[model samples]
Each structure stands twice: as structure tokens, then as C-alpha cells.
Target: MSEPALNPLLVELRERIRLLEGGAARVRSALPFGVPKIDASLPGAGLAYGALHEVAGGGPGTIDGAAAALFAAGVAARTKGPIVWCMTRPDLFFPALAQAGLHPDRVYFVESDKEEDVLANAEEALAYGGLGAVVAELVRLPMVASRRLQLAAEKTGTMALVVRRWRRPTEASDYGQPTASTTRWRVSVLPSEELPVPCVGRPNWLLELMRVKAGECAEFIVGACDASGRIDLSTGPAHRQDQAGRSFVAG
Candidate 1:
């Protein structure tokens, strides 16, 4: 008889390699963002297989919570399943989300009172595996807690978005910036020219990709949101002008 199969440890290693290759293939096929530029900026052209992303703003009246929701919703809308939005505050404007490309019917909202509970619930949802994305709103994220959440997300290949609503700079408790996220972003509303129409006014925002783990940090200006909830690229004067409007002069 030939040598008995092999050590149990060797068998397990082979199986693990097979599973890892399978998972890598799946991740390569998944594209989380409909926006090409944004996708290019993110690792793997989308949210990584297992990672915590943080969204934070300066202070109250910033509407950073809404922006986070919209961003997650937009990604979820492009993904395979519905989105789970867990929040301590009830100010997530569904209309604004609809304006950001997420269908109201595809969103599942879970309201929680405590920040810890919100994080726990989000971890649970991310572990479930069927949801497209999970968003949690909290003020701070501890390293231990984030590690647990990250492990859960990795097991299920789900994306976790954490919204940090810090009112003051000093309130950031966990070391520098108070976040255990793999990537961090700061979003703020920017001034837009007034429009005379009765439709939803021109939407503009200053999106800052403040931190990235595997790539160079960069910033770009994204114009207003249109009816389809897509960012409009023709808002600037350069894009608005017709080809004939340009004056050609000999260099």
C-alpha cells in the first residue's frame, strides 16, 4: 500500500489554500461602486473583502451622518443585496438617499440607542453574509472592538461602514483620530451656485479621502447629484461650455 494519505495538517493546508483561492476569485469579480473615479481610488476598485471604513466630519450641522448613509447606500445599491443601516440617530433622510441612487425599498433600517449596541448590531449584520453592506454610526471605535468586527466581516466577505460623529476634536478618544478603520474619509458640503428651478437644488459636496491603507491619498471635486442620484460632471464652467465657445489662438 502507498504511504497513508498525508498528515492531517497537510490535508487541512491544501483545503485552506483551495478556499482562499476561491474567495480571492469572488472578490476580484465584485465591484462595489458605480462611480469609476471613486472605485479607482479605493482598493480593488471597491471596498476590500474585510475592512472597516470610517466617515467623520467637523461637528454638528455637518450632515456627515447623511453623507455617510448616502455613500453606503450608493455602494449597496450597486452591489448584490439590500443594505442594513444601523444608526443611533433617526435623521437619515430617505429622500436624500433616493437622490443618491439607493432605492428606498432596498434599505433595512435598524434604530439603536447605544453606540456599542449599534456596533454590535452592525457586526452581526455583516456576519450574516447576504446583505450588500452595513453602516453603523458611532462617536469612537476601540481597537479591540474594531478587530472583532473586522474578523466577523472577513468571515462573511461583507463591507462595514462606521460613521463617527464627533462634535469636538478633543472627544476623539482612541489615540490619534479615534478610529480603527482601514480607511478614513471626511465629507463636507460645499457652496453651489443657486438654481432657479423648482427641482431639488444643486447638490455639491467636498469629499476628502483622508486616509487609505494601500494607496496614495488624494482628493478630487465631485459635482452635484442629479435626478438619477449620480454625480453630475458637467456643472463646472469648463464642462458647460460648447466646443465652439472656445477661442483658438496661435501659440
Candidate 2:
């Protein structure tokens, strides 16, 4: 005897699953920095999508904080969709973000008085699945909350960036604690390049890869983000340092 006919609904479900699987592969792809040295240091040769990453200033000073925020803005500017920025403070410098290539119009701000609300808003935005990325400025991120954000990002193929901020030096110490983020970075302002004329040249930054999953920690001196959100390798006497002590200068 012949087997029972296949259910039409079941056939449709199978097709949908197949399509989703293909999309998932694309969704989990990496965003390359276009600078070989930096991209090579990251797993998959770039920052992975559908993951949670953390960025913080190297110190509690406003200069370091601004550098860190601009670094994140540059990353978000390169991605495709709208950005959801959740923050407790309303002091984001829009022109600075614009200079970093993240146009103000593409960003949607979720302002709240509490850090908890900011994280909650970020989680919801990540789950929505259509955003380019979700950025949350917080003083502290508990492991449990970070885990939730990571899972949401993985499920929807959205990137989550947590910018750690502190009102005081003591609160900045909280960043030392661990979280579920795939990578953690610290950006510190460095002296700008000396120009031939008596004017300020492009800014520079010391980018420290404090933590990475399945990758070695490294550091690089790089030019600050320009109008197109791209950072060039510093032209200074080139040197490299990794956790393993491997060193090479990329020409």
C-alpha cells in the first residue's frame, strides 16, 4: 500500500526551515575592519554579528569616555539598519557621532533614568531582529543581564554593544568584573599626530583588546574614525603586542 500523503502545512514548514537556515548562516557572518592587521586578530577575521560586545573607556575621564563612545558609533555606522541607543544620560554629542560616520537620523534613542530600564530596552530592541545594532550605556552589567542580551542577539542576528560608563572612579572598577560578552575593548585617547602647520592633526587612540573569545588579546595604535567610519592604522613607528608576545609591524 502507498504511504499517506504528506501534509501541505508540513511541507511548507520544511521549506521555511530551509530558508531560515540559509539566512542564519548569513546573519552570523563577520564585519571586517578592512584593515588586515586588526581584522586578522578577530575570530572569523572580523567582529561577529549576532553577538554581544563590550566597550569602555580606559579611564573615568571625559576624553577617554568620548573616545570609547566614538569607537562604538563608528562600528554601528558601518552596519545596515537602524540603531537603538539606550542611555540614562542625555549627554551624547550628536556632532561627534556624525563625525564618526553614524548620522544622527539613523539612531533612535531610548532614554531612561535607570540603568535597568536601559538594559531592558536594549534586550527588547535586539529581539526585534530588524535593527542594525543595540547600544546601551551603563555603569554596570551583571552577568545574568549580559547573558540575556547575548541570547537575544544570537536568536535575532542583531549586534549588541554595551558602552560602560561611570560617574566616578570607584564605579569604573565594576568593569573589571566578568560578563557574557564575546569581546571587550578599552579605548584611550592618545596624542594626535603632529602636523606640519600649527594646527591639530587627526586624533589617535590606543585600542586594547581586553578580552576575546577564541582569540588572543592584542593592542593597536590607530587613527581615530573619520567621516566614513573607518580607522586607519597609525603611521607612527609601527609595533605590535599580543598576549602571546608575538610582535610584527604591518606596513
Clashing pairs in 2: none
Worst 10 residues of 1 by lDDT: 242-251
| lDDT agreement with native, every candidate | 0.61, 0.81
Model 2 alpha-carbon drift over 4 Å, by segment: 1-28, 60-64, 237-251
Query: Which tens-of-lDDT digit does each residue in 30-77 have in candidate 2?
Result: 878888988988999988899999998873243337888999999999
lDDT of 1 by residue, 1-251 (tens): 78645334324433553464442322423454456767787877766755777766422324345555565555556655556777788877778777777777876777778887787778866765555667787777888888877787777777777777655556644325444577777555444534677555464455667887786675544553444545533243332211224221110
Please report the candidate that would top TM-score against the real structure: 2
Regions of candidate 1 where Cα sits further than 4 Å from its true position: 1-37, 58-64, 167-178, 193-201, 224-229, 232-234, 237-251
| Model 1: how far residue 204 lies from native, Å | 1.4
TM-scores for all predictions: 0.71, 0.83
lDDT of 1 at 47: 64
RMSD in order of candidates: 11.3, 9.8
